[model samples]
Target chain A: MTAPEPAYVAVDWGTSSFRLWLIGRDGDVLAERRSGEGMTTAARTGFAEVLESHLAAVSAPAGLPVLICGMAGAKQGWVEAGYLDTPAALADIPAAAVRIPGAAADIRILPGLAQRDAAAPDVMRGEETQLLGAAAQLGEGDHLVCMPGTHSKWVRLSGGKVAGFSTFMTGELFEAIARNTILSHAIAEAGPISGDNAAFRTAVTRMVANPALATSQLFSVRAGSLIAGLSPVDAKARLSGTLIGLEIAGALSLVAEGTPVALVVSGGLGTLYKDALAAAGISPAVIDADAAVRNGLAAGARALWSL
Target chain B: MTAPEPAYVAVDWGTSSFRLWLIGRDGDVLAERRSGEGMTTAARTGFAEVLESHLAAVSAPAGLPVLICGMAGAKQGWVEAGYLDTPAALADIPAAAVRIPGAAADIRILPGLAQRDAAAPDVMRGEETQLLGAAAQLGEGDHLVCMPGTHSKWVRLSGGKVAGFSTFMTGELFEAIARNTILSHAIAEAGPISGDNAAFRTAVTRMVANPALATSQLFSVRAGSLIAGLSPVDAKARLSGTLIGLEIAGALSLVAEGTPVALVVSGGLGTLYKDALAAAGISPAVIDADAAVRNGLAAGARALWSL
Candidate 1:
């Protein structure tokens, strides 16, 4: 078997990092490339050059169709692919792909999802593609999808249509609070927090019990370390847990009671969020976020070029 | 009708500020001096020298005993005054003042307050003195006192005894999030938020309604600006309002409903907290924090040296 002929290239280009996967006709990942050349860098160095250089390294065939997702489709990115307003159908995302004007290949960027509610206006870029792929496994009925990241997005999906979602500034807030605030002295190294940590689970439990005391609980990190000699690791864990717990509590509030939930995540944060959810009495159906995005790009490719 | 003779010198030396007041025999402020020579600065410039220069400028009588509070008493301050454990009487705080050794003048610094519960161990330095003076005016009964600052402190005063207190990282979190997170783009300049702003009151109301949605609401500040044309002023207001409202919610949760609350703030944050509290449906009696600390210092001086 001569390694199945290459079909297309799928890219998840985020703010500060770029990832591209070459796919075979059988939907297998033929070759892959990862880089720090995200939108911020590509916008300066030229998006077309960045993409072509990666493609050349992977030895892609000339003029092969490429499906792009994430910030690369932003107004400031390679080519503007505006947002598809909710409640948008996941299947229709590919048809809305914005094609590059003068690119050599059939390069198209996927549109993001925008919730235009007057009260809670929100937006998402690459996560739309991830959700589109993840939604394939999540068939029928309603589901609360958790896509944890720097800004954790909780989406409400109904029958393959995007209803609405909320973005929680949990991870970003955790980092800022840990680095810039007085709590910096408590959690010294500012290391990665563990899910199995008792302080982590306890923080989640406390937030679920009374989410109002969040900032106060944050103060407890400093105070606990000062008065109670709380270990640095526990301090970091509690800090991480408080933000994650608050995120879960806020997300759960928007959904109907007992709505099936799916956690689409990959790596360490996956475990951290899982522990936080368990601490909040939630056991989510897990999906690999990495695979979800790849599958999403594949779906887009299949629609755009019938590859 | 001759000029009043100076009796004692009162100082409220905080982390980043230095304030000195010359008090007459009749409890009048004869002369005042303020500088940036707080604990963080005084430690390098010599706390004794910093105090003496201000005292000499005010022509404070030689050997006139000095009453100091705030970070001047921290271990990292001029000299560690330590902390008075909870259930401590406000009247008893004066007796615990730690004397500054090897000083030309008879100088003393007051002790701070510490809540040592296992789950919620907390500490406070300068605010304890403010609480001491504020308690005198409160005159018995349980009062939830709000002292808004970089770290807002809510003291539970019960019958003139320091019951317990909580410190919220509200003000600090607001600054950090506004400057460090992605929301910074939404709230340009991050100017001081107004209490009278509609967005501010709305944010406070929302937090009071569902404190769980804090981080999500924070994201709304950015999304609101991105999709809904939310103004920078309104964006900043929402950010400030969200943190302040969460603080009020947390403080209220720790107390019995309808506890007589008092706002002990000095500057702009006073109006902000008042508006936020009103939005939360509570009208707290107000106290000027600057005066509270001065009054606390006077009380300490009278108790210490019968001035």
Candidate 2:
């Protein structure tokens, strides 16, 4: 494949992951690099070095403006790009990007979104970019966008404005409970839980029906393994379903009925969440997270440098 | 504390704790022994040896019938005492106790309670004894009993029969989530969560109102700490409240409206749960767990040996 001359560099630097794409003037990907040197690793290894290595690996031209997002903007990251408090507008995000001073290349890290309400103080670093990229597909009107990951974000978007959002530690809690609690014994050797698993669907439905019974349902995983002869795979699936189902139910509780839902996700988690949402009787418009973040970075570039 | 002549020996052999009580024929305490040589330790250091040492410590009469409960009856314990299926009679439990064979002493372990339904399979070993002891205080009629611990059991008792029970992994989940997840950073050096904390009460109220939003509430603890100037104590309290509140909500859902609730708890957890129950709008009849287990063993002995 012949590589097009890179117009600019787009980076999505998350907590534990880093992805960079060289974009052509025509909006086509010229070259790409992905690594585990995200904000956490980059903070220790020097963020500039990590970015420069990835840029060099992609053979990007000198003076190409690099636009970044995610934890790179976190306080402990390369630069504290800070946050744009909610009810902030998406169009105003690029202008808020904090440039890395004294750097050889033109590099800018986009600020995150923060809801500073006393009741639900929340912050999201890299996902604002994804929301920006996927915002066009989501269109106008009321939207409840579900972004599933370590800390899942359920954002309320009206028109082009991010009204507010809630973060659920669904993925992180699942890992902690499964690995550190008695349920670990039940699912220790199990493989990845499939979205199509019957146990998975049932658990999701149950949580949505009576979310108060969530922790009790978690114990039932171990009990089921002991008395009901639940296999390790099914046990694992139940754990996954309960957490994901709780997330869906929580998100649903905040929004108005019949509001359009969009899921910005990639890979296996995408399928799992899709199935979970389906179990909860909602079909969301799906957006590939990879393209969304890249598109978000490109949007930032276009606004910042007219690329 | 005048010591009476030993009529029989009662033992609560739990997972990580061992307690032995010498009871008089008139139901008076004779001598007592407690140790960490519970089923787990005894299973390794020899169950017979552990029992013999405790018996020696109490100076029990040789061949005195010993009544045991909890994990000592599990398959991995000294003897497999099995389980009494629900809706089981409290009177029938003593009859099902498995006597340890080939021992100089007549030692019997009480059977646990099991609900083997496909939907909510559950089991309880030690807490069944607590329920048995607390049943008299609970009196006749429908009762919902909350026994908070490592595996918190919510029992549904109709008259002297146990209809069913559900276990919530509240304590275990709290430890796992606090120590194994990102929230650890928020509550790294925090003290134990108290029932009196406003944060605790507020969390309980929130969960009761909308249990589906439970996991989201968990993330708020971390978010609150990071952005809302939440102290470590409040962070810990919030985490504790979320789990406990979820348990309360789950327990309430299973019982009839306004069923008289009883709390069978012993230590600090008792106070925390009492506050949680109060927050959920229920004033439970509190029963000291220590006395309840001993009474259970005494009741079992009376039924078995007519002591």
Q: Chain B alone: TM-score in each candidate?
A: 0.98, 0.98
TM-score of 1: 0.98
lDDT of 1 by residue, B124-201 (tens): 998888987787788899999999988989999888887899999988998899899999999986566679999999
Docking model 1 quality class: high
Candidate 2 chain B: 10-residue stretch with minimal lDDT: B1-10
Q: Which CAPRI category fits model 2?
A: high
Show the lowest summed lDDT stretch of 10 residues, model 2 chain A. Answer: A1-10
Q: Give all TM-scores, in the order shown.
A: 0.98, 0.98
Model 2 lDDT per residue over A147-226, tens place: 99999999999989999999999888888888888898899889888999999999999989988889988999999998
Model 2 steric clash total: 1
Per-residue CA lDDT of model 1 for A207-248, tens digit only, reads 998999999999999999988989999999999989999888
> Which 10-residue span in candidate 1 chain A carries the lowest summed lDDT?
A185-194
Best by DockQ: 1
| Segments in model 2 whose C-alpha atoms lie over 4 Å from true places | A1-4, B1-3
